[model samples]
Target: MTLEELFAPFGLKAPPLRVLGLTLDSRRVEPGYVFVAVPGVPLPHRKPLDGHDFIPEALAKGAIAVVGERELSLPVPYLRVGDARGALAHLARHFFGEPDRKLALLGITGSKGKSTTASLLHHLLQAGEKPAALLSTVGLRLGKEARPNIGHFTTPEAPEVYGFLREAVERGLEAAVLEVSSHALALKRVEGLSYRIGVFVSFYPDDHLDLHGTAEAYFATKALLVERSHLAVLNTRLPHLKRLLPRPHLLFGPGGEVWGEGLREGEEGLRFTLHTPWGSGEAFLPMLGRYNLDNALAASAAALAYGLSLEKVLQGLATFRGVPGRMEVVQKKPFRVVIDFAHTGKSLEEALKTLRATTRGRLLLVVGAAGERDPRRREDIGRVAARLADKTFFTEEDHRTEDLQAILEALAKAAGEEGGLYEIIPDRKEAIFRALSEAREGDTVLLAGKGHERTLERGTLALPWDEKAVALEGLTALGLGGGEHP
Candidate 1:
């Protein structure tokens, strides 16, 4: 598309340039590409790398045009906009033929449960025989094909977001489910894309404080999903967010349009009666934790909003196994071992609470926090473990360029002075081994923080790491059954 045609939607005259593609990263610039020089937020221990500094590099790489907030003197065409990120979103939408309009887009945003909810909705739509695609923390899916999303962010850049939807359109997919992050909304990565339905699962003070600066700002960024969506699916349990939904919306949780009752938790899974606007039905989810039930409710509400029946939603929930790394069961023999991505205090508390209820014996926790992100959450994680776990092991989890001992000590300090049984293990693999070795019969071991992630980030290096495999190996070494519990 010509620059004029692309910028027409934004009411700005396009420069005299032909664009073949768009990118934010200068390294990815190619012939006839329009590079956007958007400034990025600086995180802890990292220098702010602005795209404006790389204009020369982009030009050298054959970028035909540049989009930025400031005008630049260059041989190539320059298009100035109030917000470069928003401009990229508009350009991407125009370039991709506005694929979101061709397909039904469902966006799920919150501090947690995004991946599981998005995946569940995708599974439900597919189970109902509707052509659907998924973009989540786990990966991307179109039709029957799924692949891991190697991008560092949950919601990729504007180009990638529209590009994926465009591909979904080509694949003949009728709908798409996306796990929209607060950063994505704040950065305008998902700008110009409208969702058929948006789901707010739950909120908590968690990661990305460095970018957002405050908990309220973080929440406001997430609240954008509700504002831009055609319809909002809200979790009524979080009363603080209720005021954000003054307009018409579908509610979930207690006394909401979709809620769960008659809840029963066991080693096998959970059995609950799912209440929806359409109707109500008993759902036996082969997944652990009440939080998962919340995720199920969110997905069910979204699916029902898309014209799916309650029976189909229940069937999809029943047939669905679970999302990888989110409360995944590794083994069930003398005791139970679960791997979960419970990095936040809220998620950790919920996971431990559920395990404590179901576990007949002691609840053992192996948890840690990522370095160079939010240090405050480190203590919160420790405090949660201190309150719920019979024994806790504070170990290394993605301590990129940060002092390992300092991170462990912070966690140990937050564990409180109640004289709880805890240990500081810097080595993650050894920590898992020690936890498993100390476990007696009927004890439930939870390996939290690193769930389905296959690698461990340590000081700018991504080492091969698998929590489930490591737990299974530890079980096998103890002569316990490595197979999953039936």
Candidate 2:
């Protein structure tokens, strides 16, 4: 398409320069590409380069057109827009032939359970013989092929989103499930796309305070998805979210359209009777925790909203094992070791509470807070650990450019004098070893933070790290080969 045609969506006139693709990164610019120069926000660990500074580099890379907040005096066609990020979304949508319109898009956004809900919905659609794709905190799946999300972003950049959607359409996929984050909405990363069904799992006042400035602002950003969605699926338990409910919306929770009764938690999984508008049926999910039952209900509600049968939803839920690093049980022997991505205070509390109930003996917890992120929850997490666990080990978790000792000390202080059972270990592997080495028969160790992640961020480097792998190594070093407890 010509540069003029591409900028026409933004109501800007451009020279008749042909373009092959669009990009924000100068390094990705190819011959005949249209580059969008969006300003970057300064982060705690690293400062982003101003896209305006890369104009010359992008031009040298054979970019035929440039989109920016301000016009530039360049030989190539230059188009100025009020918001370059929003313009990028529009241009990408136009370039990709609006793939979102061609595919059924379901967006699940909240402070928690997005990954689980998206994965379950995708599994339901696929099991029903309906073609579907998924994008979540865990990974990206296209049909039968899936890969880990090494990028570590819940919602990818707009270009990648459109690119993936285009590929899904090319492959004849009928639906796409995405886990949308609050940061993505705040940054306008998902500007031009609309969702067929948007689900709100749950909310809490944690994380991303440095960016959003206040809890209200953070929630306002999340509400954007509900505003733009054709059908909104909300958790009625969260009273604040009820204002977002529109006509044709489905509420799920206690006293909602999709509710759970006779909830029973067992060591293996959860067995609950689901009460839905379609009918009431018994459902058993092969996963731990009550929060997971809520996740299952959210996914089932979304599938039903998308026109799937209740039987298919139950079948999919039954066959579905679980998402990795989400209360993932790595061992069930002399002592059970579970790996989970419960970094927030509320999530950590839920995890510890669930384990405390089922654990046969003492419950030990390994926990840490990420550096350069929200520090407000560190104390809350420590407090939760102090109240619930028999022993707590505070260790390193993504201490990017921050002193690991300081982070550990803050948590230690939060545990206070009353909680004397906790110890601070700067090295994560040693902390895991200490926790496992001290464990006896019938004890359970909960490893929080860094679930499916394969790297540990220290300073500016992401060293290779995996919690389950490290735990296995610790077990081997201690001469305790893999075995289950009687």
Candidate 3:
């Protein structure tokens, strides 16, 4: 498609201009392609060599044209847009042949549970015989085939997001479940894509404080997804959920559209009595926490909204084993070992509380704060571990450029009450082993962060690592628990 044809729908009046492909990254720009200069978060409107300096580099790199906000003194055809990111999303839709036009799309966005909910919805729909695909932090999954999404951006680059959807459509996926993020929504990554249903699992005011500046802005950005959808599945029980989405929506509660009551947590998983509008059933999810119940309910609403049979929905929900890293139980030796991706304060508290509810013995939690994220939540995460966990071990979680020990110290300070139960372990492998070695038969060890991530990144190295594998190895070495794995 030509550049003129791509932006024609967005009211860009231009003479015919040849275009082969589209990309925002200069390194990936090729001949006959338009290079979109996105105003990055850190250096807005500034090119690499210097502000206004890298236009020559981009031009020299075979970029036929450039699309950016600032006026460039380039000889090639350059188009300016009010917001480059928004324009990119719109152009991506056009470039990808508007794949959503032929498929059903569902978007789930929140501070937490987005991954689990999207996965759950995809699994449920697939079990009901609907062709489904899932896009989330975990990766893109089309049926049983999973692919690593190296796109660091949660929403991914707009072009890449649309490209994934195009692939899904080409693969004959009937339904697509996208895990939307606040940054993605704010940047209009999901723009031009129609969603049949939207699910708001729950929201917390941590992570991405740098992007949104304030909680209200963060929430308002996320609400854009719900507003754009045909129907919204919401947890009316949450104050933030109600406040952000004030419109009349499908409520999931006790006896609501999809409700969970009589929730009991145990070593096996969470046993919750589900009461839906269709009928009542009990689900034994191999996941912990009341928050996860909300995830299941949100997923159930998505399934029902897709017009599945009641029996299918219940069966799907009942048979769902668990999502990797979202409160996944790894070792059940003398004690229980859980590996979860609970990095946020709210998630940490919820995981601990769920463990407390079901654990017959003590709770030993190993947690860490991610480097270069919302630093404010670091201390709060520690405090949550301190308050709820019997033993808390703080370590480094993807430090990036930040000091690992500094991160641990901040976590330690926030763990005001957990001083005695806390220890700083810089090495993650040792941290896991130490936790396992200390755990007794009845105790539960919770390994937080890096749940399903197959790689553990330390500095410039990304070594192969899996939490469940490490936990099992530790358990085997300790001669404790045994269970089945796929």
Q: Choose the strongest candidate by TM-score.
A: 2
Q: Lowest-lDDT window of 10 residues in candidate 2?
A: 477-486
**Model 1, span 202-310: residue lDDT tens:** 8876567888988888888888899888899999876466667786689999878789999988777789998876988899888888778888889999998899888
What digit string (tens of lDDT, one per residue) describes model 2 on residues 203-250? 776557788878888888888888888999989877475578645689
* Decoy 1 TM-score against native: 0.91
Estimate the overall C-alpha local distance difference test score of candidate 1: 0.86
lDDT of 2 at 56: 93
Off by over 4 Å in 1: 1-20, 30-32, 42-47, 205-208, 240-242, 416-418, 476-486
Candidates 1 and 3: which is better by TM-score?
1
Error of 1 at 141 (Å): 1.5
**What lDDT does candidate 1 reach at residue 214?**
85
Give the clashing residue pairs of candidate 3, or none: 333-480, 333-481, 334-441
Q: What's each prediction's TM-score?
A: 0.91, 0.92, 0.88
Off by over 4 Å in 2: 1-5, 11-21, 26-33, 42-49, 54-64, 481-486
- Mark the 10 consecutive residues where model 1 has the least summed lDDT: 477-486
